[model samples]
Target: SIKLVLKMLDRQMAVIDKNIDGMLKEHFAEKLALFKDFKGVGPCMQAALMGALPELGQLTHAQIGKLVGVAPLNADSGRHKGKRITWGGRATVRTTLYMAALSAIRYNPVIKTFYERLLANGKLKKVALVACMHKMLTIMNAIVKSGIPWNPEHQNVSKNA
Candidate 1:
């Protein structure tokens, strides 16, 4: 239901976006006006990011991953040959983040290039996409951490993940 509401809100916003030339005098007009030009990010992704991490403005990358349930958990045991990885966090958050990741690939140049490079390196299609998602979350963490909006030209240096 949350996603549904977001989708509807996005649609309404899109309609308004298409006719923004004459709606510049309303209250909070300046802030609302920015929505007319806010490309790349959409309502659903924005809502998800805000809802999934209300304190995103204060959290670190590790905390963000843990919040979204993407940080792999320990699965080692006495007889296990390898660790058993699993998804044990909020399913909805993970799904919404993944969708946001896909949209970033379409709209964000840095992410799109990284995704293409990964594909060119012979990574499996799904694997490359997930890597793109991970990188996006890391980028988001750094952006929020610095209290700055995303800048495509600024190269993100950390590859620790």
Candidate 2:
């Protein structure tokens, strides 16, 4: 009986996945095509971009970062200054972006290089990871704005994603 219940749940999940795939293709075909070549953007990230942050291609890099909670903000109060940190924004999208950044750190050359550079410069791993998330968001914003697929050589990450 337990095995049957698990099988049923699996089949339902497959159906949901199929429905989501179709929906994404139907509404975001152009964006999906452009995003396909990006190294760390998987199904969850795609869904997050489409559902949680529909303003993906519509905003500037800085705007997108703040909207997704990846940009570091000042946490200072007069003489007693606190550390700069990310605050506010779409929590769901931020969580999804975190996972995507982790993947990019491993596989995306530009992001991997940036991460290593930060680590060498004495940034903590978590700090570097957040920077990567911001970078990835910048890259995605550029790709959507330019309507260009991922081309490592012709990257628009000049703003340094």
Number of the predicted model whose TM-score against the real structure is largest: 2
What lDDT is obtained when candidate 1 is compared to the true structure? Answer: 0.63
lDDT of each: 0.63, 0.91
- Model 1 per-residue lDDT at 62: 68
For candidate 1, the per-residue lDDT at 5 reads 100
> What TM-score does structure 2 among the candidates reach?
0.93
C-alpha root-mean-square deviation, candidate 1:
7.9
lDDT of 2 by residue, 73-131 (tens): 98889898899999899999899989999999999888898999999999999999999
List residue ranges in candidate 1 displaced over 4 A: 1-40, 72-75, 78-86, 156-161
